[model samples]
Target: MSETTLDTRTVPHDMDAEMAALGGMLLTPSAAADVAELLNAADFYRPAHQTIYRAAAALMDRGDPVDAISVNAELDKLGEINRVGGAPYLHTLAASIPTAANAAYYARIVADKALLRRLVETGTRVAQIGYTGEGEAAALVEDAQAEMMAITSGAEPEEDAFFRSFMPQVVAGIEDRANADTNLVGLPTGLNDLDELTRGFRPGQLITVGARPSLGKSTLALDMVRAASVNAEDPAPAAFFSLEMGRNELGERLLSAQARVAFTRIQAGTVDDADWARMAEAMPRINAAPVAVRDDVNDLRIIRSVCRRMKATTGLRLVVVDYLQLVETGERSENRQQDVSAVSGALKAMAKELGVTVIALSQLNRGPESRDDKKPRMSELRESGSIEQDSDMVILLHRDDFYDQESVRAGEADLFVVKHRNGPTATLTAAFQGHYARFMDMARG
Candidate 1:
């Protein structure tokens, strides 16, 4: 099409389809349910059609018949009779279609046209953004991608399947599990006991790992990443957003943990020959692992953008946020609790949207230290507004040696599963090797 023709073209809409859908619903009240599944008021291009559709939906919702008279009455009740062209328009719609059986088909057509219109609008907005050059080029691109993602995700047809329709898939999953050697599902954390108790971390799950300072929360998160990516029989792609640590620091920690070298020695630049050899041996596996790390970004929007990109490009299965307190929501609230709450909620939403397991590190408040028992509680999560509520699982790390150097469980850590939405809560013990900057299953240790 020529430029002028393209510019002059009307926005996408099918008046015939809209009228047919409405007529089908009015003719066959039962078809209202089918049409309602596909189209909403906003989907109609004409305001009158939108009003009519709303009236019909309201009548259906209230168990009232959805015919021309009832719909006209509904419009009159809402003081919109004149706006929708009076009773004549409702009668016209009722006779527009030959059969109500095609209501869903007409609704689908209307939905497609609405989706195309939205795409056109999105393209125009993106072009405007490009012309304005109002923000950083990278941020602008992120915004554009986000807009496109929203359109595409919203355009997806929701499946309203009954329980009988879902049984086949559920039974298949059960059979798969029964045939498998291990009962572990989802991504493994590499800790045998924890994996047994919680199964693996599932997609769309927001897992919180909380601890006081120097308690190896970050180490545990890295361990999970390593297990899922570098150490798995079939490695998967993973992402780590380190707001607290720099790229170099994370690399050093990962190397130390994977190589079983003393973190102190690596930090102090006192690595010996054996440590070098171990690191050399671990290098190939680390290089082969498809793990992406971002240390510069702190905003939750940018983090989510990166996750979406990774999910699209690499089929990302896991995401780890190093210590949630440092994450910003791009819009600060007066109350710090509200800010943290927003970040936590966004992280959870991101996990569900991207279908990835998100392990977010959190910090515990001083409530643990004030009590005789230094074990961190779910209530002690710093700015504990919605973190507990948002997370699918809340793991509180407690190392006895952190409080008492001479304690019996000196080299062990207790992972307190305070909140498990899908399973029972329990405390699991694992070997905490501080020197190596990693955690391991006690049996393996």
Candidate 2:
């Protein structure tokens, strides 16, 4: 097949909307600043319109006049008068819009058309890559998804803005929160004490749950998933990406946790009549919950793909990765530490981009075990301290009896909030039932 060309492909665009937008700006120069927020220069389908928009945006930035004469002068200064049909095109644009009152509407139309064009171009590139069999298929898919997200979110480089421009949004958010009846400021973690301390997990937060082997890190993660997603009539949906465990095994653990049955018994298939009764009672809660578990996922791209799909379909709000070390970075790095650091940073960005709370389980290094206290600290976060730096909250799990059999805190675990970006940092204790693979709040007499 011959190389493809942009002219041959049919792309979605509205020339009238582009012209109207430019015309509105020309009619009312004051609205150029507002319109610039919605539509970039590239949003115009026609080259001349693109040039005109850029000139108008420049004039607005400089706080200068933005009429047809000024825009044509600016375009002439840039030596593109002949390329865009000189000052006549600018005059035509100014004459097109009846009023600047609908500037935002015209801008939206142009933006929507730009998004469609981006989809077509990206889809064609992805298809061509697939046909040519160039690069890794997974990487190609991930790149396509990233491009789609960029287009969907209208992501762009940050520009300097005055504090006065942003103060209204901040004040409005505070007023909204003040008017809200619920005290919880963010998504509920379903743990009362933890919720009281942190006000629950907020969106765009990368929370790390770190621990040594057999300290119930996975169990705690699963418990949090249940807390966030289950037991509500219409709970916020969640997904768990487990690289260490199988889906069936995680499901069994969920069943055990929900029914308060011994996980060992569930695994051994030796449930008695009483356990069967409890399991029957737990089935409805499990069935009504909106959560997905993918135990086979080891690649970050696949996890991202799953989260995006879930967010689009079920409106996902929380994501739990069983362990961080198990995630494949999809690129060859110099060392394991560098790879881990890269993955940690990517997970933080993913949380922000997806607008979800991401809880990633991590393994602590031997530094914690060598200490006399046996408590895991921030420095012990396994292969990379970047996990600590990237995370909005770092929770280190410690069960004393996991190391010492005769300790008094045998049935308890400590979730030490070593780092919390927006709230109090403290340890919250919970009752740990290893047999049932469940964590519960400790009862106070």
If candidate 2 were superposed on the true structure by all CA atoms, what would the RMSD be? 14.8
Model 2, 42-62: lDDT tens per residue? Answer: 888898888888888787655
lDDT score, candidate 1, position 193: 86
**Least lDDT summed over 10 consecutive residues: which range in candidate 1?**
1-10
Pairs with steric clashes in candidate 2 = none
Q: What TM-score should be assigned to candidate 1? A: 0.66
Backbone clashes (count) for model 1: 0
Q: Quote the lDDT for 307 in model 2.
A: 77
Cα RMSD for candidates in order: 17.7, 14.8
For model 1, residues 1-445, the per-residue Cα lDDT tens digits are 3232248889999999999999988887556766876788989999999999999888865667778999999999999999989998888987888899888889999999999998999999898788788989999999999888877576554574467777998899889888988878789898988898888999899999999987889889999999899999988799999888898998999999999889999999999999999999999999999999899999887787677645543568999999799998888578889889998999899888677999999998998999787878898899956999999999999988889988988899999999999899999989988888899888752
lDDT of every model, 2 decimals: 0.88, 0.84
